[model samples]
Target chain A: MGSETESARRLLTGWGRTAPSAAEVIRPATTEALVSALSRRPARGVIARGLGRSYGDVAQNGGGTVLDMTGLDAIHAFDPDQGTITVAAGCSLAALLDRVVAAGWFLPVTPGTRFVTVGGAIACDVHGKNHHRDGSFGEHVTALTLLTASGDMLDLTPEGTPDEFWATVGGLGLTGIVISATIQLLRVDSSAIRVDTERTADLAETFAKLRASDDTYRYSVAWLDCAAAGRLGRGIAIQGDHATRDEVDSVPPVPGLKPRISSPRWLSLAPILRSPAISILNEVHFRRARTAAGQIEAIEPFFYPLDAVGDWNRMYGRGGFLQYQFVVPLDREDVVHTALELLHRERIRSTLAVLKRFGPGSRAPLSFPMLGWTLALDIALPAPRAARVLAAIDEHVAESGGRVYLAKDSRLRQELVDVMNPRLPEWNTVRRRLDPDGVFQQDLARRLGLTGASP
Target chain B: MNDAFGLPSRIVVLGGGSEIGQAIVAAIVAEKPADVVLAGRTPVTLPDVPAARSLERIEFDATATESHGAFFDSLFAAGDVDLVVLAFGVVGEQAVAEQDPAAAVEIAMTNYVGAVSSLTHVSTRLAAQGHGTIVVLSSVAGQKARRSNSVYGSSKAGLDAFTEGLQLASLGTGVGVIHVRPGFVKTKMTANLKAAPFATTAEAVATAVVAELGKGNRTVWVPAILRPVMWLIRAMPPRVLRSL
Candidate 1:
């Protein structure tokens, strides 16, 4: 405890590098230190940050204290027979997967980037391509420990404390600080994925294919070429599952976890991407992908292709970029079409657009996913005109009983909080009960009115 | 905190009663800045915008350079201020000022000396906080002195240079400084004078300032065409410029 010193302030932003803020970041290497640090609540309060994978301000607290949990990253125990792993909250999913896959186990749910920590995974209740079949990361958790604002450590489980567990699962780190968690791991034969790819001519075909064949595949997602105006919704549907030993002719070494090369920080392809050249580039990509089946690929490329290029966010330029990801109920598929048409009409091009079908949402009130169609896109900043289009989309989403994922948001209006997530009141009640003084807070919580009122 | 689109949530206008300052605040009313501080010599009435969460007035005299340090310290100590607008200046009539040295000095003191003093304190406070931007309202008259308004123009010239230098000094401090040069804005300052070429209204200047801030631009021209117009005007030799 005596070793701890006053940490210097750091300017932090999410993976998207937008809306950065300054906070005094303290790295607590032990649970005892983390708890002690939380006990002294600064005026602006404290929030925990992992690898800063969240796209916006979810992990930031301007003029506040940010607990850097990466220090307490020890994987305490692993049970092969029962397929359970107990690890500190600061342990990153990349570290956990490397260890588990070598032992014939896999993460039940993984987001696009494996750079996220266990604490962030539970805080956002992240969903993966296999969400329709396996559910979110929080659904697989067996037990967890939370350090409440009152300095009380809680041992929570789904069965033992449903209210506290569900609330903390997707609470956006507003309820309390998650110290450590015990997760249930899935068994896999190899660290390879058996993938099937197909090209869809337009939005209709892509939707039809995903709706028809999504059930057969354990994991499925579609990448849309939005710049292709001729075939507006043109895309490629990718589906895959963990490969069995019999399915693989020969097993290759596990792919490297760290990115080998990084995109130049000064390089900005935004101007070119915003021009007609985007249409040609996306068309070439669409034409290059051929219909193929039974292709064995490494897990790294299959799960996190962008992770191959570190600091890829810099490609959008210094102004940074925004990832607008939203989920609309399955019946409101027209909203997705409306969004694409609006972007085309406005002459705004999305560098990368992804479409997926989500299963039923979890018990957590603020959880973003539900039985719906979700579209995520990357748009460069300084496109102030994009704000109007997004606000209109937010209205449509809220009206359809859908909502934008707070994890990937930076520009959402505060008024839409209740309309989008009706369960917010319920979540806030539990959050307030846990931290009556609201000692745990963040920029996202304040920006979106996540906790209702500031402490 | 800035919104997802980079619209600042907390805004401060040093020259609170300045027409251009209020116009800029009014322009961003739709975004709903949480806190708006209007500090000037006199009590300033709230703008027409009712969507703002809180609007407060504090007494700040630009001529009172000695009190600026304490004034800014208490303001920033309250909380993090996202945007600061240094919009206090006087446009003295050159004809009346050439005969009266005291009047010329008054213009110089208010426009140049006052700005340097206030900005020094504002910049220090914002830099220490690690996040915030200061927008200084300069004038196109500062581009080159006209015999018609030499006193006012020269004062603005000093401010323009200081603001740009402060921008460089602010590098790596996480604080931003933007220079806003408006050609001719129609407000109380120019109400009795003839409208200049491409003369704009205070509302127009506000619109451009807010939009440029959103784009994270270091400098902006009110009408935008003035950028090219000023370039050509600057190319003429002093011998040819003396005819005006």
Candidate 2:
């Protein structure tokens, strides 16, 4: 009997899997089916869910109807001449790349994982390590089809419908369900990256090296050893760009897009993921890197190394882990140091930490990337003192004119939303016009008070 | 919503007057400031815990079973509650309970019937909200019934069973349940009774339960030894149990 009821209601969660909510899920394989699902108008409202890789509650609609767009995944068109492709909102980047990579094309921008759906990418306005060069995913989108609250499909683009287009970009799917989208892909000769590796002595050196080579490198990121006490900010900087035919040894077999191994559900490494063990792991990783330049690497290892280990999040245990990512302006780089010092003082250990430099800010109101340094880290749950310490850092970041990434945040305070995302009011104005009835809602919207008082 | 450390930002205590209940709230507030709501039939004075951000009291009668559905609906309608401690229960004297049928009925109604009614409503609300922890203060008395305290023991037994099942029902919903079993916790309710073996205090039970909340533990035994002791107590012969 319990199994019957449990099967009826779908329990949804983000990649982090920290907070889960149950909802009635409806998969629409066609436009007509999507419209039929939308017409139901559940009392709690409706929202769209993709591959569920936003890291938080961005894709969840608790007690409401969730449109599982994965069923509508069909590549509508492909224009190799124009370097563009039109795919369904539910289409995964991995699937799209698999079709395009062999033909010398790639996603203009991508996050750490390629399993995310096209709709989620535009909804989050995801940025890659090349954010310093190419901006965000939304910037590369040529056009999109939005199904508004009133049940009207509107074709939108940056120029044709600036307000609605930008609103849908990093909109967290609150505006409406995205039906389909046309994205401009980057042209590549081979599926390999010519990389340059540098081990920085400290945070300042890493920042200086990144800033010094900002224009020279098309893509760059640093892996910081936050757990190392004396060598607190020491890191390894990896910068690279797509390799031409001459740069790689036969293009690495067109790059395998699927995950080779999956992490078992029963296995848990939480006990050993503590401070002592993590510090040792961090030390070994730091020492292992060499100052090698022009190292040829496959696209898989260069961008999505963790993706190879499927369901890697299970390693954090059932309590789940949080990925706290915040971006501070270039001048406020000291905030990064303060956050690391505070975490150390509170005796909190971050298992993984990545530091990246972003270029100019996005036009979209809720977009996360800006011309600054962003530090993202993962902390295993039940860290008793982590709340107070992270809240303190949130305050400092807000005051320093920085913002945390909503796509990755699970516990950011509601009051800090306005201060961090100053353009929230502007986004709300556009969102209200598009969804005046407020038919689309999500858990992240309610938790962070993103939307005004509930309908 | 819980913060980064899993510290509940908002907490609700059903039996506001229970010493063990108030102690649990104190333990949480000691860690960090949180908004607390104490609900009971009798109005409870705001505890002077400086760490608590805000303390509010409301009327909540355990025996009023029919009103539970509406009561919880309104409570959750206001906002999401992170932690809810169901501590409202009466410990009636077994001697008086056996002699007076009405007394035994009152004890059963308050502890078992009322718990079922209120917990059913609380679970529905928390499950819909998708994130929260329900802490149930069960007892070692429920481990096995004693001839001396059969009525009260049986009442706890029912609650213990219900809470265990509720924990399973709540799986995958992100709602956690902590079934707390304490042996002879010395509180105002148990002040008149003689202290049992390996006796503990209400504060000690509170500390253990609060610590277990962050660990994702479903069952907590105060003083820690009651768990092992209960094992032996359950295995004892009926003839040997009757002597005690």
Judged by DockQ, which candidate is best?
A: 1
**Deviation in Å, model 2, residue A99 alpha carbon:** 2.4
DockQ list for all candidates: 0.36, 0.35
lDDT tens digits, residues A97-203, model 2?
88888788888998998889999999999999999999999999999999988889999999989999998999999889889999999998877889999999998
Which pairs clash inside model 1? A410-B4
* TM-score of chain A in every predicted structure: 0.96, 0.96
Q: Please write out the lDDT profile of model 2 over residues B1-244, one tens digit for every residue.
A: 5543456768899988888999999988766667788998867553555567777788998999888888888888777787899998888888999999999999999999999988899888877866678899988999999876789999999999999999889987767888999889888888988888889988998878867664443898887998998999899998988887
Segments of candidate 1 deviating more than 4 angstroms = A1-6, A268-274, B14-19, B30-47, B50-80, B99-130, B196-204, B214-217, B223-243
10 residues in a row with least lDDT, candidate 2 chain A: A1-10
Cα lDDT of candidate 1 equals 0.84
Question: Could you say which candidate leads in TM-score?
Answer: 2
